[model samples]
Target: MSIITFEHSFFTYPQQIKSLISEGLVDFGAWYLMNDEQTSRRFEGLQTRYPDRRLYPFAKRDDNDDIACFDGSDNTTVHVIHDFANSGWEQKEIFPNIDAWLEYAEECNLQNESS
Candidate 1:
């Protein structure tokens, strides 16, 4: 079963991301929506140390051992940073945008249900 829990009230996430969570659109395993601080702490060198770009991490993939996924501010793409001590994100884009990501998440959850 997929669970939606929000505990990081001290920080604010993107508007579209909040909408997806509120509307019950996300079910990518256990979505651990973390604030900037928590995300930085968990992901280590990848997020916090990168001074040149903005990476706002909001969730991790529980099924995938909490691989951190974050929002890249300039573009509509959400990036996946799978490695620790890496200054920048991996070359592949996690999702094109929030809307498309949510749709794919929904599909992934549905597939999990039939498994």
Candidate 2:
């Protein structure tokens, strides 16, 4: 089993996510794992000061601001951090799971490449 080492706990990743990391599709250093290097990028650097405000950051958004996180408490549903109209900041579900999230990310990558 592949494990990501951290001070508090070791993080286990899904097979598909592991594959993406191996394939260089996902930045494991900046996503998937919570290391010192990634702390600043998560939640657009908000997590450093407001750790209570984050769900569980997994990836960064297409705009390079905000973060893609998952609700580790209730359900492991994927969420992207965003500033809503009146809600201020929130975890917006974009995909159901890591698999679906990866597919969406691939689509975005392709779009960026083509553009």
Candidate 3:
């Protein structure tokens, strides 16, 4: 399982998107760049280079990182940090950073690996 890290949260709005693109923080056909048609078009010209890989955006409704057993097929799942609600820890606060979220993911992966 390969994980890509973005400097900003997935819910980041417009200007941040442009800034990320300008800064080369995202790659063409990457989920952060090709998740939407508007952004996807920017890489349409390079489709031949990345033929097999289609971008899959993190689905907002199914944002939780819970695992579901699927009938043996190649599938991609994205775990967005915003989906988990802060349960009154530090007065019900939320920490929104990819680094923190990635740490959570690493912990989950570690537990899964141990089990």
Candidate 4:
């Protein structure tokens, strides 16, 4: 019943995503996916706009891949996982949109409340 709020959507390669999941950092609860080009542009824009914001690239496949995951949080925060390809990544089955994710979260919350 936890609610995860994202100021932006994250896009990365398969291996990095897998590592994140394996590390228990981001659980596949709910998530959104943007195309690689869109993600790159957005990431660049954010970097230019907010130079002070510490950006951590979430790369797990030997750090040579063009794909990257960025973390702009202070502590290790959980993100809803979505759009994962079957490249040896393990995650919980969940929807791939904000509305559906929120709906599921709300349902779980309501169930907990009733119980």
Best by lDDT: 1
Clashes within 3 Å, all models in order: 0, 0, 0, 1
Q: Compared to the true structure, candidate 3 yields what TM-score?
A: 0.27
lDDT of 1 by residue, 1-115 (tens): 4443333443345667666668765545544455446565554544455656455555666676334355444435666555443555443447777667656656657777899
How many collisions between residues are there in candidate 1? 0
Pairs that collide in candidate 2 are none
Residue 111 shift from truth in candidate 4, angstroms:
14
Tell me, by TM-score, which candidate is best. Answer: 2
Q: How much RMSD separates candidate 3 from the native structure? A: 14.7
- Give the per-residue lDDT of model 4 (tens digit) for 3-111: 2222234533334344434465443222223333445554575455445543333321221222223445522332232223333242233344333543555564566
CA deviation > 4 Å runs, candidate 2: 1-25, 28-36, 40-54, 83-93
Worst 10 residues of 2 by lDDT: 4-13
Which of the two, 1 or 2, has more TM-score?
2
Q: Which stretches of candidate 1 lie over 4 Å from their true place?
A: 1-13, 21-32, 35-37, 48-54, 66-72, 85-92
Model 2 whole-model lDDT (C-alpha atoms): 0.52
How far off is residue 49 in model 3, in Å? Answer: 38
Better of 1 and 4 by TM-score: 1
lDDT ranking from best to worst?
1, 2, 4, 3
| Better candidate by lDDT, 1 or 2 | 1
